[model samples]
Target: MDDDLRERVEREAEKHALLNAVKHESDADVGAVMGPLMGDNPEFREHADAVPGLIGGVIGRVNDLEYDEKRARLEELAPEELAEIEAEDEADEHDLPDLPRADDHDEIRMRCAPNPNGPWHVGHARMPAVIGTYKQRYDGWFCVRFDDTDPETKRPDLEAYDAILEDLDYLGFEPDATFKASDRLDIYYDHARKLIDMGGAYTCSCSGEEFSELKNSGEACPHRDKDAETVLSEFEDMIGGVYDSGEMVLRIKTDIEHKNPALRDWVAFRMIDTPHPREEAEEYRCWPMLDFQSAIDDHIIGITHIIRGIDLQDSAKRQGFLYDYFGWEYPEVVHWGHVQIDAYDVKMSTSTLSELIEDGELDGWDDPRAPTLKSLRRRGIRGEAIVDAMIGLGTSTSDVDLAMSTIYANNRELIDEETDRRFLVRDGNEVPLGGSPPDEANPQLHPNHEDRGVRKIPVGDAVLLESDDLPQREERVWLKGLGCFQYTRDTLQYTGEDIEVVREGDVDVVHWAPARESVPVRMRTMEGDVTGRAEPGVAELATDEMVQFVRVGFARIDHVPSGVADDSSDDELVVYYAHP
Candidate 1:
């Protein structure tokens, strides 16, 4: 290869390696480095014999450079410029699916209606991510509506309402409008009256068991054919509190022998005397069923598009009756299958989660074991990671059962570059040094970015090493960047400053912290709390700052040094482990 061509190939290869390493937060593979270089410069392939050597040289050079430097350089570019680059990169991946008939609309409107019975879980994130993307694509409005009408079975909690909103905000969705179903009780009541006057609905006074038997047998209830005048009168009686709970229910008129049993005359409203957490106590005795309230709200709020799970298709059919009665067009509907992550094993239902919390089986909704969004956030899982994973799934109708690794992989891509690195020694064993220890050891804040500066940890004659990393037999080991050491039992005898000597010995390299300068660390892992010791600098980290605990995994600092001198800084630092 000519000198000029060789230089160009080398430069391109270096850029490719740097970008890849920065993105993945790990060493770039030879194939990953060469693929982009070869694609960008086809001429390089002509000299295939020299290509491997050139790529290897470039990779070595790139490895010498710190990741934070590349990240800082990338951040120097304008926001729009960065976005364009990301757009091009994402297009190359072709991960996001195209919206169905996205170009045909002048305006698009979408909503995510979540019942505020409990905090949102990871599954709940799919709707906002999917709907938010469509809203962005078509430059339309996005809304969040709390469907909290049920007070008996799925009662609403004030904390749950706030938590759901907080999760949405963390996911980067700002709703153009917000609605609470309880606040629209008057509107639902008016719609029920309209259905009754139009002879499309009637009040039924059948016992619970009697109605269930009749519906199961495809037989109409005795009151199903009541005239509008009498039905209206009975509905008035229900509103007047003359009917006890489960004794009276307003049913929407549908096919008595509909092919699907669930589609047969569905109940629209029921009498519930339970007090709502937010609304007045027992002020409204009649509560509209979810389908009834949602249908009315969707129409009244002028929702143009409805994207939801395929399981709710029956709900659409039920709501269709009301739409027909009021002479209103049903919004365009699209359904996708459930996105199930069976690796969690834990149930994601709000009612079940509430029970678990009540029984003290969980620390709280934000516990690392729970799949709630608050828990994910506490563990340092970014909203962008959730968005990427959801969008990658697209709108497939088939049910998807994914492993936890699916999300962890997505999260690693986004966090690896940004999260700082720190050393942690769990269940530490004292390793006494033979030679004099240096006063301080400086390690780069990030391996790939030297320009980001170093973190200085005070050194001593003894260092804390993870119990697992203790040498079982005499062997040469590298004590990270500080120097080489000869390990024998609990002794880490200083040998030389050259890391190459330890690397050549074919021994394991382990991370350690100076015994005197280290601070206690308690990480809340998915399994349980793991106590350890981390470098003193770890205690200085700001709340919510994500950091990789060297061999331990990534974690988010949950507690930091408080301003008051309460000795909290001396206490074990608390963190929530994100993932390995």
Candidate 2:
């Protein structure tokens, strides 16, 4: 039994070592290598005394194999190939920005609190990467708190709560804890009472227009001078449903004569009758405002750092009073300016996007035209690329207005190596060949990665070409991977098989698909959908599989023809173009 147990552990250890070697491209540490073995093979734990020696032996053998393979590959590679690999390694070291240092004794804690009013857009997606990076850097805890207090203006949608979580997960960020502001109403109520008892807040029954006039003139409302006992009574009445919506509000006592009008006795809590999607609305009539709720939550939740946009600077200022009133230290606030990619030319607000979707202006939040995170994911943009682009911009205060090319360039570098190449000709026009073509044309799946193998596309006498690719005059053109041809009217005269020959001349290199073997293609770009024809192999791609359409750009398969169980090569292939 002991011998059998030892042999099984040894075999598992060896298998793990080889997997680690391939993953890390080198020998993994014995401690790191043991993690998987112990978790996967409980029998190894039972025979723990023999595990260390077994792990060491397996790691040693794997290291030897890795060294031999690396050495042989180095000998086969050209000098430029070696230099390029070294350069890529160096570039990776500086990909993400260096986080600012924090106090060592402070328990690092970060929160991504988003309002669950609408689906997350590209702008909202930025927070997860930024907050996730800080958490990773400080080895801190991350919390996803839904700020669903405002039901009148920005109404919370129940579906958006799950959608937001899905977006965060897709972006490689998983929260250590999840919370909803509505669930913590009792806590907010307790804090509100504390503020009232401390004489830092009071109840105001002034009408909106009357309060606006007083606030603009830096004059206090008549209710501001009420004693704590009086204010507490009114607050109880407000919470007890005695006050109608907008009839009364709880105002934090800030300097009425303060220069900033917004800072002049801001409303801390307000009466709203609208029922919360996830809560009993009638039970809680007075809801804490955004800044007030955020301040209380931040301190109670032990948030050490707050990363947000610079536009919310006033929020920090307003929350400062509450922090000071309670004698609590505020979290270190890091602010970044807006990131505008003008090429998208769409409104970045979730409310606006929601309206558009409601009005049938957009298909849905995942429509290729929309800049929602789901749309980006559907369009084949990797979450890592989004992180890279955002981190590359760093946490600067200056607003950045860049072209879509900036993001596309960052994304292209990430997907270039992994994406398989396929042919797609838009509005395909038949090109008749003068002579018989080769039986098959094999193109490398990736131009730089030979190990990816080749895709064999059958070649026939007639091929479908993009109508735009055909020149008005007779000229040589290279049909990629097949052969070169010269077009005269409708007939393409055979030139030569050498691509170099066509390259040396004024020939246009174009991609083509076998006329009969081509599948119907519809590519959804940011502008609109473009109808075309793709190689038959494209239909074999699984949903969400990203591929490059030779001169067209990268795209992810959105849908294949319905009921085609195995491969839908003969059916319509729908894809969402990510970027060029």
Candidate RMSDs in order: 8.4, 13.2
Stretches off by above 4 angstroms in model 2 are: 1-101, 279-283, 472-474, 495-497, 562-571
TM-score, one value per model? 0.83, 0.80
lDDT (C-alpha) at residue 219 in model 1? 96
Q: Judge candidate 1 at residue 232 and give its lDDT.
A: 88
TM-score (C-alpha) between model 2 and the true structure: 0.80
Question: In candidate 2, what are the lDDT values of residues 1-580, reduced to their tens digit?
Answer: 2456557776767666655554457775675566566656644432332356556876786677755564444435333545555676667565455555576436688899999988798877678888888788778888999998988798998899999999998888899999999888778889999999989999998999999999998888999989999999998888787889999899999899988888888998999997777755546778989999999999989988888889999899999999999999888888889988666656988998998999999999999889888898899888777776777677788897656566676677677667888998898898777766677878768654568888888776778988777756577777777776878878887766665454233455678888777778878989998988777788788998999887677899988885332234455678999986
lDDT (10s digit) by residue, model 1, range 5-45: 66777777766776677667777777666545654565553
Task: Indicate the TM-score of model 1.
Answer: 0.83
Candidate 1 has which clashing residue pairs, if any?
66-448, 66-449, 67-448, 67-449
**In model 1, how large is the Cα lDDT of residue 251?**
96
Name the weakest run of 10 consecutive residues (lDDT summed) in model 2: 42-51
lDDT of 2 at 514: 80
Shift in Å, residue 281, candidate 1: 6.6
